[model samples]
Every structure is written in structure tokens, then in C-alpha cells.
Target: MNSPSLVATASITSPHRVGCQAGVQIGQACWELYCLEHGIYPDGVPYNDYGDGNLDPFFSETKEGRYVPRTLFVDLEPSVVDEVRHGVYRDLFRPDDLVTHTEDAANNFARGRYSVGQEVVRKVLNRIRKQAEACSGLQGFMFFHSFGGGTGSGFMSLLLEKVMEEFTSPSMLRFAVFPSPRMSTAVVEPYNAVLHASTTMEYDHCVFVFDNEATYNLCINKLHRAIAAIRVKKTVQFVEWCPTGFKLGINSGPPTVVPGGDLAKTNRAVCMLANTTAFREAWARVNLKFDLMYSKRAFVHWYAGEGLEEAELSEARENMAQLERDYEEVDGHDDDLMDNHEF
Candidate 1:
């Protein structure tokens, strides 16, 4: 129940990571994250050993590995396909995963009759629905897209309405983008944003929204000033928040040195490089708000009765003991260290 089974769809990203095609870069990030998750946890990996009732993946590894998630992409843009097929996305996803529409939906979502987007959306979901029926392991579905664009917003609207009508077993979640003023491409973006948002009120169980400007503007002064970053509970994990700033030091001169090594030159050079207006790293402070989740009672009745069949009460007890052992291991394992301390 702690590590929820994740099946990521797609979302936008900072242009620093993926120049203009931040949307597609999100797919690449998902693949990399899926592959590298084990490395993140020395023992910190999320449990994802579900969803494998012969629901054959889009691709398989060289030596018959059992570790692959079912991936499917529904899109209308041929260029998106070209870039993905030839770029980083191809390195992660195979050609079998693509679920492309013949014609592009050009800002006409309000008029769904004009495009094949809805038809394709229904077809893909229907194909997967049959597969899902064979296995009770379809934990959830994650819908991701930018609200401003026609295809993402329009096709997504169709998905939200139809997915509920089609399947009732898996829970629904959304990773939606609240388009910022600068990045929105369509003139009718206001209508799309409101329409998508209002629609989510009915269909989606939970929606996580990320703003464009908030992601791009990375100033330590605003996000995490140096003193605020490393004061008390602040530690090495908080180093990203401790960035000073950045400056236009690309073509700037080599810094002048003080006669007696005053360190003023080095300091000036650093300040010039990080001149308070540059991008600072975003802090991973999402945990701060998670306390609110515990403030209210959860509808966890279904979760209690559902899970792996082999699990037992003894396994639960051993897991608790393992947590106590992990806390001890964090201190590098001493037999009687803090033995006299009060629990």
C-alpha cells in the first residue's frame, strides 16, 4: 500500500531538459526512470511486480527479461512520431507502442466530428480493455497532456468521458498541465484550459497540475535561499535548494586576482557566474504538503482486502521488523549504540 503501482502516460517538461519537445521528452524520462528506479534505492525501489498476466509488452529485452511495462502512445502528429522514432524516445520505446491517428486534430476539439482522434482513442482503449479483463492487475491508468493544445486537451476530453463508460475496474488519475501565458500555442487556449479542467471534476479521481513559468523560473531567492536550505533539518539532500544564482559569465574575462590572495576575485567571479537572476535548482519539498493527506480519513477499505495473494500476517510483521532494522542500519550498525536511550 505504501508504494503505489505506477503506469505513467505523458506530461510536459522544462525546456532545459528537452528543448522544445518537452511533451515527448516526458516519455523518455518515464522509460529512464523505470529502468533506473532500482539504482535510486539501494533498497529504495518501488514494488512493481504486478501487471504481468501474459499482457505481452510492446517490446522485450535480449534474454527474455520479465521487467517491462505495457506502453501505448496515442498521437495525431506525424512529426511527433518522426522525432520519437529517430530520437531518445525510440531508444526507450519500440515501434510497436505507437497508436497514431491518420489525421491531425487542429484546434477543433469542440468539434470532435472533424477528426479521427476520438475513433483512435476508443480503439486503443478497447484493445487494452480486452487484455485487462484477462488479468485483475490493472491497478490504474494515468492520463497526461497539456491543457492548451488541441490534440492533448481535445483527445483527452474524449478519453475522460469514454474511459469511464468503457472500464470500471481500474482507478483513474491525471497528470495535467496548466498552461502558462508564454508557452501556450493556441489562441483558443483559454477555452481549452477551462473545458479540460471542468471536465476533470467529474471523471478524474486525482489531478496533479504543474505550471509552465513555475517550472522554468528557478531562483534560489524565491524557491530556497542558502540560509533557508541548509539550516536545521536541511542536509546534503537539500543541496539543490542551495544554489546562489547564475550570470552572463560565458564570454566574461578571467577574473583579476588580489595581490595577497584576498579571495575577492574568486568571489566576484562566482557571483558574476551566479548573478542572482539565473536558474536555481527546484527543491523536492512535496513532502511538506503530504501531512494534509493524513489530516483526513482515507477510503482505504478496498485496498485492505485487495493485494498479492501470497502475502500473510507474518510477512507483515517481518516487514515491520525490517523497518526497525533499516533504521538501525542507517547508523552503520553498532550492537549497543544508544541502547540506554529511552524509546
Candidate 2:
């Protein structure tokens, strides 16, 4: 038998109630889906005795034959995690895997990265290390977060930096929810998103950008089927040195929408795994917004008060600008070289 390729997932959210709910709900949905796929119940018990599916990628068997998810739910505040503790799928997760703090990030990226977030980072890292040690052959990490929130952007960036430094070999994939201007909850979202993007750009190997406005439009305007196509040969562009692109997969059935969720019920669904230069568009737009505020130095004091240096902000802006140019250069290149080579 081949060694199990264990992939640990971390669901981190901002201190905002909405962000927290989104993250926790997504985590719960994924756990439920995994259990359903593997013939396991919500309490971690198998449905029947004869099922032989490979559950090692996201689960670990306990002494009582119960399967626990190799997933972690983290927040800067305890209310969200407390819900998980009392939730229906509570039994599926270990108590130590749910990490939280008494203080919140207060919608400030600097606070999340430098102040309040630092207090719980060590404990969270210890738990993550224990999870890593339990795995036989660890493959990589999958991070679920939002770019618009404080903890999601700043705290997640810090965690990604540390994880990249320690793991080194495993590929890191991010499922990042980008903020929409029309639906934005916080004014500092642009700043948080840009800074987070610049900080974690080099750390993440692959990122699937999810836009709230775009998804809403797709669901409202074109409601028949969920078909999102990105042509790698023409529309998509990848970095020359890195293995980056998009992989399209169409599931046979519709997505399982959680109760009281915002998603619309559909007949079909499509998922796009991407690490393309096209993501630079998001960076560019957010950077433009960042410039609007940074030009006036609006609300810069909040971050500065939380130990963020003026030079770091400037550096983050420049880094994202440079990244956009890098993507443009990659996009201008011919696909001939990539066609002949293999990643």
C-alpha cells in the first residue's frame, strides 16, 4: 500500500462576526461532506462495517475507531469557536484543535499581526505541530480565509509565513475569498487585502480567488449551470519559474448548501484550482483602492499605533506593484517554452 498523503487544513477567520461565521460554516460543511463521502457519521463512527474508503488524507483513526478530522479552526475571539464547540459536528473535531483568544483584532491588520494575534500564535503553532507529527507522510496545507478581514488577512499571513518556514517542502494552497467593493463591510479592507496579498504572495504556491460580487452575479444572472471556464492556452498565464495554472473539474451533482447559507441551490457546480497570473488583477484593483486611502494617510495611525512601521506599509505597496508587473511580464511571454517543458 502507498503511504497516506495527509493534507492538513486550517480554517482561519477575522474577528468580525460575519467572517467568523463564514469560516466556521465552511469548515463544518467540508467536514460533513468528507464524512458523507467516507461513510462516516457526524460523530465519527462509520456507517457500516464493510466500507473501505481511504480516509487518511483528512482523518485520523482514534483508539475507539472514531475518525477525527485533521483540521483546525482558528479565530482571534472565542464566540465563533464556542459555537463550533456546541455545534452539531462538535464531536468530529478535537477540543484542542479549536483555537481562540479573549481579545479581538478590532478590524485592524496591524493588531492582528503584531499585537493580539501574537498572544495565541504559539499555542496554535504547537497544536499544528502536534498534528503534523501525527501524520505518516504529510503532503501539504490548505488554508481557507478571507482577504478582507483583520485576522483573516493579518493573522493568516503570519501563520502562512511560519508554516512556510517550517514545512519548506510541502506545497501550500489557499482558498482566499476576495472582498467586493459593493459588499465590503470595512473601509480598511483594501489595506488589509493588499498588505496580506503582498506578504503571503511568495509563501502560497497556489491560490483560488473567490470574488463575492462575481459569484453573486453569476448566480443571479446565469442561474442554469455553474460553468466557469479559464483557458490556459489563451486566457490564463502562469509564472515562468513556478508550476502555476488552472485545473478545471466539474462535479456531477450540485453543491451541498448548508442550512441558512447564502449560496443558491443549483443543479451543477464547477471548481477551478488556479495559480495563474490572472490573480494579479485582484491585486491591482485592491492596490488602486489602497493608494486612494494611503495618499491621504487616512486611518494610518491605527496600524501605526499597533506597531506597524511606515516603511513596512510602503514596502508592502511596492511589493504588490512589483508583483503586478511581474505578472504582466509573464503574460507577455509566449506559451511555446512552457509547452515543451514539464512542471
Q: Per-prediction TM-score, please?
A: 0.52, 0.82
Q: Write the per-residue lDDT of candidate 2 for residues 128-197, one digit (tens) a residue.
A: 8899889898777777777877788888888887777777577776777787777777889888887888
> What local lDDT score does residue 173 receive in model 1, on the 0 to 100 scale?
64
RMSD of 1: 18.9
Highest TM-score: give the candidate number.
2
What overall lDDT goes with each candidate model? Answer: 0.45, 0.74
* lDDT (tens digit, per residue) of candidate 1 on 130-203: 54553335566666666655556666777667767876755876665655556555444444444454454567
Candidate 2 RMSD to the correct structure: 5.9
Alpha-carbon error at 339 in model 2, in Å?
28
